[model samples]
Target: MKKAIFLMVLALVFLTPQLSVHADGPDQMIIINKVNNQLYYFDDGTLIRQFPVATGKEDTPTPEGAFTLANKIKNRPWYKENIPGGAANNPLGKRWLGLKVGHNRGHMYGIHGNIRESSIGKYVTNGCIRMHNNDVYWLFNQVAVGTPVIVTRFQGNVEEFAARSGYHVMTWDGEMVDEFQIGRVETLRPMKLYSYNEKGEPIAMQWVPANTRYQVYATDGKGTYTVGSNKYLLYTTPNDTKYELVPSYIKR
Candidate 1:
């Protein structure tokens, strides 16, 4: 009986899941959405906060891949080229979260505060992700070394996860879009519209009228939606008098 009881206890221990030290921490992951220029903070699979960020420029775009936060620095000085840190002209803002990405573990790319506030929503950085000084300082305090940092071109799965978590849907310009529950249509209306290809350019000038329904499948970074099978661009009139679509959805 004693031997059998001991074996049962060993089996229970083996079957139990071991919690990772990194996963149990409040600040375990940071996801950078390059497409919409946003940074998402997740603590144990829950989103803690999000902030707008500026990524790499066209020529020297921010690296798109997974990385680990290797170091944290307060009032870090910049030393790239001849520029010095702590100077008024220094681009590195108030804090820095260094990243270790790719085979170049020694790479100097990181997430840091920026002096140019206007560059927050634009792709103007030289590889490092740039955030507002105040925002970075707040984030720097939340995370620790070895936290996972994923940089991607699009939000994709993270968007869906955040939506399900009851987070507000926001456009790149910070406009709030209506919350849409899955498997439900918000509003249906009849309207006349023209057809446009996936590129958003007009395909034909002929206007087609039909009753259409709106469902939120995916929204672009600019807060535009392509609804239904024909992929109509959902928009509103300048005066906000009525909602319009590029190509009217006509049912057969």
Candidate 2:
């Protein structure tokens, strides 16, 4: 009995460090939506924060795919093409989150702050994701090294991609909608339609008829709009089915 007890204690000691490390493991996931020019931050499967970002230009498009946050540097020096870091005109803002993108780990691309605050919502970067100085500083402190970062140019809105990718969908009002619902707002032009479940799971993909119209009652930040008193997220008629939002019908 004594020998068994001693072995158990040794095992407990060995497991303690492992448990502690896992207890403090990374709890954040970042998705950079290139199409919408937005950055979404998720903690433990829930979206906790979002920020507008500037992506790469057409000629120098931002690299898309999965990457790991490999390094975090504050006030990093910039010496690209003889442009010194800390210069008034330096593009690197106040913080940098370097990425380990695939086999190219030479610090070629990353997410950083920019001095040009006006460019926050535009696609004007050479390739890196640019954020406001305050925003980057906040993000730098929230995420730790080795966190997972996915940079992708989504085909639709962030909500659609998030639902399709199995991430929890958050409404603009901060409500969590687990089941996927169709958007009901009709667009003047035809658009692709996708259906999803409460857990943000995709159920179907199709195309809507062109020139459809609907009276909008409500909208969810994820591109879902309600129509009529029934509040149907999707409206189907004999000749047409609609889910895309009409920009003019939006309440603002």
Candidate 3:
């Protein structure tokens, strides 16, 4: 009962939910969902802002991972295009949140404002995430260096996605995730769909059919998978007394 505050609040709010970051935990976090083409910003576990964003095309998919804000830059120069920082024609735009995806620590790719406002919400970046000029400026001011940055492509609201991904959530949920690949899970026996409490702990919601299959949203890398809207299925622990549940993953 003391583990799922994030999920319950999100279920209630449906749009924005606040999560309290524990000691040494990052109070500021940014999540970029390529599938939805949206960006969510959280401060001290509370959702502060969100905006439409543009990500990489299929051929140049954004590198998905749990990164940190390596640096913050205003009017960052577009070196490849030879456009100076603060240039009206620069593609990097008015602000930059350097997402450290590799050894380069995001000097190569990051979240930045786009020269083309119409590109927001579309799949068009070379690899970096794109936001509106003003939106990026707002985001750049909201967080400091070393903030957590998660880039994923899962299908769910922020709370469910983060909780299921094991972001300091309740229960046996394991290590935090950088990204979520689509997955298929087969239920061995009948299982009740579960919801989390205010503390982020699981509470049985309703009974689901036996031997059924579901395309889950995200896994804790332990066993539980988010199967439905704010719903979870503990596939590893079944009522049938047989342990035959097998999960498969798809490359997102």
Scored by lDDT, model 3 comes in at 0.65
Pairs in steric clash, model 1: 78-85
**Candidate 3, TM-score vs. the true structure?**
0.57
For model 1, what is the C-alpha lDDT against the true structure?
0.58
Evaluate all candidate structures by whole-model CA lDDT and list the values in order: 0.58, 0.62, 0.65
Q: Write the per-residue lDDT of candidate 3 for residues 37-115, one digit (tens) a residue.
A: 9987765434566799999988998887667788898888888878899998999987888876668886888889988
Candidate that would win on TM-score: 3
TM-score of 2: 0.56
How would you encode candidate 1's per-residue C-alpha lDDT over 1-252 as one tens digit per residue? 000000011112223221112222224567787778989886533456789999999999887655678788776777765555556677888678888766555237989888789999899989899999889989988887877666765434553333222222232112222333121122333333335877879454433333344544454435344455435555433232233322111111
Name the 10 consecutive residues with the lowest summed lDDT in model 2.
Answer: 1-10
Task: Give the poorly placed runs of model 3, Cα more than 4 Å off.
Answer: 1-25, 166-252
Model 1: what TM-score?
0.53
Q: Is candidate 1 or candidate 2 better by lDDT?
A: 2
What TM-score would each prediction reach against the true structure?
A: 0.53, 0.56, 0.57
Residue 188 displacement in candidate 1 (angstroms): 16
Candidate 2 residues lying further than 4 Å off, grouped into runs, are: 1-25, 82-84, 155-160, 163-173, 176-252
Better of 1 and 3 by TM-score: 3
Cα miss at 215, model 1 (Å)? 22
